[model samples]
Target chain A: MDNSQLFFDFAPIWQARTLLLEGFGIAMFSAVAGIFFAILLGLIVALMRLSRYRALRAIAFTYTQLFRGVPLYVLVLWIYFGLVYAVGIDIPRIPSGIIALALLNSGYLSETFRSGILAVEKGQREAGEALGLRPWQVSRFIVLPQAGRIVVPPTGNQFVDAIKDSAILSIIGVPELMKVAQEQANMYYRPFEFYTVAGLLYLIAVIIVSKGISKLEQRLARFSRASKEASSGERRPSEVGG
Target chain B: MSETLLQLRNVGKRFGDHVVLKDINLDIAKGEVVCVIGPSGSGKSTLLRCINFIAPPEEGEVIFEGRTWKRFHSAFNFIANRKYEAKLPTLRAEIGMVFQHFNVFPHMTAIENVVLGLTKVRGNTRNVAREIAERSLRQVGLGDKLDQYPEKLSGGQKQRVAIARALALNPKVMLFDEVTSALDPELVTGILDEMRRLASDGMTMVVVTHEMNFAFQVATRIVFMDAGRIVTIGTPEEIRNTTEPRARAFLSSILG
Candidate 1:
């Protein structure tokens, strides 16, 4: 074949744009859902690891080890296929994909959260406790808020990873971005063109989300600087002194 | 002394085998300012911490307002520890503490830092907490910085917010753990003056400090500790004229 015959064509990509967009939507849904659950699950596991009880710490330790040691691909397959055969309960494709992503990411995120919580000064916790706060109240009100600030940048990276990892769900026929690309490529006999569009779609989503995270981090920092000055201003004299 | 407000009887603490406090027996009477002074490794901070149960006594008891906690709850004894955990908040509520680092919540504005204890622990409404926080911040001369985060404040200002955080709770006794140590030399007097005002208001307090002049002027009594034990304790005048060799040496070193 001549070099011209092998050149990239833009027509196939334009024709499949709608299908590609739908697939992109499904892929993002799984990632967002997975990230939401991962965040909550990660916090619980992190707390358990930091718990005073030996049993709790051990359990949390084992959970992080088991999940982190397994590849995301294997985890997705186990939930989608192994669970059905072994437990006689078949989880639907999308939910199964979400569960796998959540489980895998929670293991990494729990470690991230644990480090963030530990990064808070011990004095902060003591200050809270000194004010007669219950242990959980101290953690909830003081430690976690400070830890949340410390963990934001790292957690944003995890969100990006979740978006990329969502592609692994294609093997289970979840009709996510990768699966749609595969089907479109075969139907149109233009693998390179369809695949390129899917890659670009993922890249666009990631860039937008990362930009959003950066904005969020800036907002948090700004809020910490001057927030709630107005609420207490009711009692203050009109002069705002530095 | 009028009615003992806090008592530590044979209180002891250790990190592994290295003792931080040993057989510490002290009594803080109502409306008295007791200042603990000592060398760097002498356990003055740990002694103050014991009063608030920040560093729970490994042996003996801490009695506050007639209620007592004998050592901290153990993790091995889950059921009993749970009960102890429930009781601790009430016991600790009566005592307030400030740290050397001025550990104001970096994420919170000064008012929010002060309001947290009131709303969360005392169950005060937001309005009530705000009123109390404002009063406390103003008392510490931080009225202008009420909206500022700890990171935006100076060391002295952060310490003021920390003081306000503790004061807003209306604790029966306040513990100051080297509260002015982290301040710039010029800013030290402001914090000391704020503390002096608190002393004049008859707030029961236990202060661990390195500032001899402040200790001499404000403390109703001075405790000199060395090697995890109280070497001597007396009124400021008596401590100045202390005859005990260990206490005398420490005093001379600080004066120089």
Candidate 2:
């Protein structure tokens, strides 16, 4: 009994191009949309957490802690399975998946943003004040620009995180990449081939997103010429796209 | 004496258990440089901060123009005026401040730094703000370095840019907080020269400085503080004569 019947193939996936492409589209869509919402929510939560009002700080803290502590799968399930049916409202699974991932990412990214805001030096704030900038203006014009450069790497990681986490929403019946892979594997009884294909697709997507983010960071990093002298990671212009 | 431009009446401030400033009353007139000199922890900087309403003195009032600056709230937050914090940009625009460490915005060019307050707070057009910034930068002898970032500047040049930043606002009263303390001894003269030029131009200024010679030459009146109080307020000649023990001690300690 030489049970050596296991084999790998990419031909089947290629034949199922339309299905794979549609699933890829959904995955990409959710990642992009989720990140937009996450950054927006993170900005709001960060500001609230930094506010002088105790109640606001408490509320922001609760949102950050509760969501961050909960697993991404649990939050997605709670929103798609528990909240939707409980409210007796018929919502689409695609949007529900994006919302869950965004809400969860916001909780995580807000902490990143808060740390970034803190990274700004005390002198910069005072500089804005002495110039007579309003408090909000100082935060908007000076601190946020400085904080943004600091938070770039973390935020790029979060974007990829959201993209990968979007796959988990397939349990709630979202037709994302993982959903397509699971069905294809079951129908063809080739789990290895289907899963590996899905994984590689995600890797490619992440590489593109990561490279784009690094370029943006490079532009932002150029603003602080002083920091560059001390910063360890210096990108030579010739190294770009090499 | 000329017209009174700014008056601090019975101003007092404290930090937790320590009294940083108390019963600090001073009058500033137009075209006068009022230099506040004292030993460390003498509250000269704190008093300058209170003048710009940075700390919002816990006690007493600041009468500037026709408006009065007093405590709007009791909170210890960094916001200058709690109730009018929104409007403070306008008030602060009228009264500019230069810090000891030259707090120029590192992210912006020298010209951009100079014009930020004008465009952002004063609502001036971009072209108008740039023109004013360029002119002010020229006045500070940084006309050619307007495009340089703060990190590219020397201590003297950075402080000059900071001064230009404040000067662009055309403030009624300029507050200088140890602007030369952080510069090299050689760099100190450039900023002192700028201050002297400003003084001769009839700009009302309140300067908290450790530069005794600068105070002697430029200040119309000298205020010597110790232990969080103004020990003596007199002309440069009077401070030079040294009647008050605290002033004499501080002057001798610093001058020598």
Which candidate wins on lDDT?
1
- Residue runs of model 1 more than 4 Å from their true location after superposition: A1-6, A222-242, B72-78
Tens digits of per-residue lDDT, candidate 1, A158-202, equal 999999999999999999999999998998788888888889989
Docking class of 1: acceptable
What is the Cα-based lDDT of residue B196 in candidate 2? 90
What tens digits encode model 2's per-residue C-alpha lDDT throughout B1-256?
A: 9888899999999889888899989888888899998877888888988876777688998888868877755556546565556666667878889987676777889999988888997889999999999999999999999999877889899899989998898889999988886677898887898899898998999998877788898899999898889999999999899788888877788778
iRMS of candidate 1, Å: 10.9
In model 2, the number of clashes is 0
Per-model C-alpha RMSD: 6.2, 6.2
Residue pairs in collision within model 2: none
* Fnat per predicted structure, each in turn: 0.59, 0.43
Residue B130 error for model 1, in Å?
Answer: 0.9
Model 2: docking quality category? acceptable
Q: How many Å off is the CA of A14 in candidate 2?
A: 1.4
Instruction: Kindly give the number of clashing pairs for every candidate.
Output: 0, 0
